[model samples]
Target: MTQKKRIVIKIGSSSLTSLHGEISRRKLKRIAEEVVELKEEGHEVLLVSSGAVAAGYRKLGCVERPTALTEKQAAASIGQGLLMEAYSEYFLSHGYVASQILITRTDFSEEKRYKNARNTLKILLDRGIIPIVNENDTVTIDRLKFGDNDTLSAKVAGLVDADQLIILSDIDGLYDSDPRKNPNAELVRDVKEITPEIEASAGDPGSAAGTGGMKSKIEAFKITMASGIHAFLGKAGVRGLLLDAANGTASGTYFTPAEKTLDSRKQWIAFNSGPEGTVTVDQNAKNVLTAHTGELQAEHVISVSGRFKNGAVVRLKDENEEEIGLGIINYSSEQLQHFRELDEEAKAIVDSEGLVCRIDVPLPATI
Candidate 1:
């Protein structure tokens, strides 16, 4: 079997729908056609699409974004149908099958759900089906939301270990500053690093239907790039943008990956799962974790914050709050406290059964 290269393409609401909040069939067809061409080239493709709310609002006879959550949900409920119909029909014409996968932020919030989503997506790809993904706006709360499709696309890219994440916006590429305001703002063709300084150059959200703008795109780029997935932010209307991006053209601001694909798992661990709790370890604990040794001992811990059940993931940090490592805790926060009081033999008995009760001496004393 040939090694498959995976690509994630995200289209902004502005790129998919008209300024008047209607789905543009012509635009959708063009985008689908380009994607079909990519699939013909034997690359696995996943599309993260927006424009559901915009489509829903138009169908419901509303001309503006709804303020109420129920109204927003209603819009999404109505729009998701219209969006998938278009995608399914278009792909069908091209002799390709497109699968609609509506995911909520909750799916990626937990490990099991995230793994299930990944496996499902993999099955779709293996069957030579293009998976069209959108966030489940109808059922998600603001706290469990991806905020916008940009972040959703990046997370999806990481989940699939995509080789590249192409973000299609209305702009040709990201500029050094908001070109609309600063006429002197230069078009940055390529971005090697996404520093806070570079991020400050991004503009605000430009469309009422779209939640993310250049700023969010930059954030997505930084995230995907850090996960060893290259990200390209470019204009969507260009006739061959997708093809160009896939073939490695000097188009848009390309953020190169800094790590290997295997390293992305740890990067995902570091960035995705919010640590359940923090373990403030003494100097000795800090040294052990930094060395990437085995389990941490109870004697090395100074304090534990937040309730963490056994086998829960926790952050090991120094007294200064700098994170040293993240690992599954051998004992819960409450259990570790009592376990630490045991003597060497007693502690060893508990530790030998996959517990941590031994404490190593800390590093040099700080004056």
Candidate 2:
């Protein structure tokens, strides 16, 4: 790493588990050592790891991984402390401090709390402390869950405006076809854009211990790419993997960011602060917003669905009920239903100057 960079590494449960599907100390030590080396080289590192369930299930006196939600949560409660203890011990031996941050979706949904998390992480990173992040599975409900840690890692990468995100898995890289099914599957070493074919080829979790598979990784890349953060997906436990990925020479699939990126404010609006409702607009407004060169006006809004207060993020849809993008609406659902035209005095908005309706964030392209 020639220039100092902020990097986030996501390690899945499969990478940290043994053949019997339990936490492996050797794998954890290897990851911690590489991270310490990265820190010594003047680079900031944040880890988003998933192994609580794997580490705690056996301790819960189970023969294998538990499928029930309550059982999973119980396992996490037992494993989180053990996982952190190991991480702290390894990092402390290397003369470094490791802090733990366990968060749920609500932390990112509320703007105030989101900014606070960002600020806290910024302070830790500045002080040369590596913040290890994980989803607070003990109390998280399915409705507010992030689905998988892969999604959590991508969101965190955007939260800190990381320069790059490295996702470590058991697979070496993405293949055109399922390697297990097809004997001659070709590894896709570089990817500039995620095409429809690529999305279609993404399959379910390959390992019994993992929750998110190739599909989840692809979805995670969409968030990073939209935020203008480069990302790499590669096999874990490879020697010098972190350094090589940062230097752009790793044996993995690299994802290039979009030319136009969303800033911190926009990223929060787009990826976090989950939409409260949908605002339907005319075809013309939808076209302009997705094209990256347009502003939304109250006159263009045809209708509003769902109850949302003013200053809330809402999904922007078209006449046909197709989602175009998302933005912070100035008027509440009740207010928009009452009147169509927003006068200048009310400050409907102008290119997000008065903060009325800002909808420049683009969604992923569909086939």
lDDT of each residue in 1-367, candidate 1, tens digit only: 3335799999988888977888999999999999998888898999999988888986777768887788888899999999999999999998999988998776875678888898999999888999999989888878778888998899899888888899998888888888899889887877777766787888889877789988888778767866778888888889988988877683777778755332544544545665688788788766665665645666667788889887666777789987666666768888887766778788777766764522221122000
Error of 1 at 112 (Å): 2.2
| TM-score for candidate 1 | 0.89
Checking candidate 2 for backbone clashes, the offending pairs are none
RMSD per candidate (Å) reads 4.6, 3.3
Clash count of each predicted structure: 1, 0
**Regions of model 1 farther than 4 Å from truth:** 1-4, 260-264, 293-295, 340-367
TM-score of each: 0.89, 0.92
Residue-wise lDDT of candidate 2 within 1-367, one digit each (tens)?
2888999999999888888777789999999989988898889999999999889889998898999989999999988988999999999999999999999999999999999999999999999999999999899988989999999999999999899999999899999998989999999998888888999999998888979999999999988988899999999999999988988888989999988788899889888888899888898887778876757766677888899999999888889877787778887888777656556555344324433476746554310
Relative to the true structure, how large is the alpha-carbon lDDT of every model? 0.79, 0.88
